[model samples]
Target: MSFFGELGNPHFRSFEGDIPDNREESIDVEGEGREVVPDATILYTAASFTDRGQVLVEPTGPVLGKAEDAPIDVVGITEGSRVLQINPQETGAEIVVIDIHHTTAQGEEREIAGTASITVGDDGVPTLGSSEPVEQLSTSIAIRGAGAQVAADDHIYLQYSLYEAETGELIDTTWPASPILLDLEGTMEGLQTGIAEAPVGSRLLIQIPAHQAQGTDDLIAIVDILAVHEDEDVDDDMESEPTSTSEPTELSSTEGE
Candidate 1:
């Protein structure tokens, strides 16, 4: 990813004044992208693609509210193009793209806008990420259930979305697919506590903090329990996602961890 000084660098740019009110688009909590053309140096932005496959960057701007190019110091880089940047001045957090450029023999300049996006289900990117390390397990119930309680040893049937805490993108999900049946005997503490905290028919959002995430980043699981039983007495035709030979959630192997 070389730097580019070209006016059309898609990830970032600057405006002498406010971006045209008609052209600007507000970034949602998820992220945003906009198309823009200057009086001369026309440029467009908005839209994201996965980089190395470990993270997802929600594009937050084409109009960053103001123009500032203060260099954001590099904090870290993962195994690939993903870079972690930090601005010493917290107030400088207003996101903007840094145009790195080097002229080519043919007078072409290459640039990496630093903007990234991911649709999840990539190599290891999850549907959700923490953007920062998760320090502790956090659980929130999306939908509460009034059914039977999930015991410490219950074999439960559920659908879930799993995310790696590092890059904060979705890695796996059971939506539109068969639910998983888990024998909670040897699952991780985060999984055990989080699931036990919820009842059958509830949707639980659990954030497995870094410390409990084994050797990987934090694991975030959004579980939707469909049923619970004392044993694996599920209908014979029931196929489970956790143990599915096709695309298994890595958590399946973490039962004893």
Candidate 2:
């Protein structure tokens, strides 16, 4: 989603700053001899319309929150001006945006102002931060589940969140639903190495260097090893399945159908 900087070139201009708090700006539009503003065929920014579209926005002051720009995608335009209700999609968890108060290296924890204490709810994605780049791999246990130590033969269920270690911006997560299931041998080397010695139910906060990360970017993850099963069913399924052989099998023309 983008914002508009100017009212004339609605889509062309980039808008920034906080949205007006008091009320939404409304401009007047008449279907008289005035030229029609073109209807937008492509995605327009928040409340922006083309010259061919007769769109009007009322005059309003900055009453919105500290954010100066609107977070929405304007996808439609019409000949007549009307109120457009733009709903911003919540793409990630509700996280407290924090700026580094000072310059420091990774693993350095200091107080940040204007930041709130966040509680990662059940099914909620957790957030983490670092001052600078992660020089080496590190791990901190966030939660220790009750169970035996994880083993290579175990099938592990996990809920994890990966973030950019340098910026602390969240990249991905498996929580609130849809967890990851894997055997130690099938998982990534970084994950396998990090969780190898940890016990089942252990929530690890791991900081990984770019070399160890999947995308070659400094990363940090909060991983919850939910459960570990013996996975005998996997072995059984493999054994029951027929293996491909060099022998050719005859097929009918309508075999697929």
Candidate 3:
């Protein structure tokens, strides 16, 4: 499938006509299509008509925290609010936004917004600019590895396996499982941690010091990077063959005679 097809479709739903003032008012979405549920981390782009009728654009990406914010972005909006844009660019028109408030993993209560982006059609979203090209680093053996290609100001999702410390075995059963957000330093740490020490094909497990494991003393993770994929376009100047200085000389009349 084409990369965009793999990404699917994206759509938007609103709980009410306005964006919520507090995080307590948010909503939940379920089933097929994009549903913005309470407490779900979401990024939203909204365009509203100002008193003069010019469109006012306000874009915010926020995490939901409470019931009052059940419907994220429920305030400053009303019925007949025009749908200006949606995310993921693949879901079609099947989007739902609810009004409620909720909290996040960090225990911050805030109003939530609803929007859904899915991978469904077209070429994948384009990553523009060269400031941050997709960065990748492979292990010496090419077995376990982790790397990421990021665009400026883009949120990245990182997933790695946590493992046992002594036996080099995987510890699949645990809380806060799956990949989480990594700060800039952590992102770099992920790229460099085991690339040198782990053998190729051997799963490299990094033991999270109790202080760094987010309050979990026994939590350890095995980062087994199956493969890393990236798209890079080489310029003509960088092509492999050297440029030919002169065209082949026409057959000499004297030689032929």
Poorly placed runs, candidate 1 (over 4 Å): 1-132, 230-249, 253-257
Q: For candidate 1, write residues 1-257 as lDDT tens digits.
A: 21222221334222233223232222211111111112111011222222222212333211111111112221121111212122122222223232211000111122212222222353322234233455677666645665567887776666577777667677777653344556665566687777885656566667787555555678777676655533222222111112221324455435355
Predicted candidate 3 versus true structure: per-residue lDDT over 103-179, tens digit per residue:
11111122211111111124211111111111222222212222232332232223344433334344442112222
Candidate 2 lDDT over residue span 160-248, tens digit each: 67777667777776443334445665544565677777766566777777666554577766776644433222212112111211111
| Model 2 lDDT-worst window of ten | 95-104
Which of candidates 1 and 2 is the stronger one according to TM-score? 1
TM-score, per-candidate, Cα-based: 0.42, 0.42, 0.27
Say which prediction, candidate 1 or candidate 3, comes out ahead on TM-score.
Answer: 1
Q: How many backbone clashes does candidate 1 have?
A: 14
Question: TM-score: which is higher, 2 or 3?
Answer: 2
Highest TM-score: give the candidate number. Answer: 1
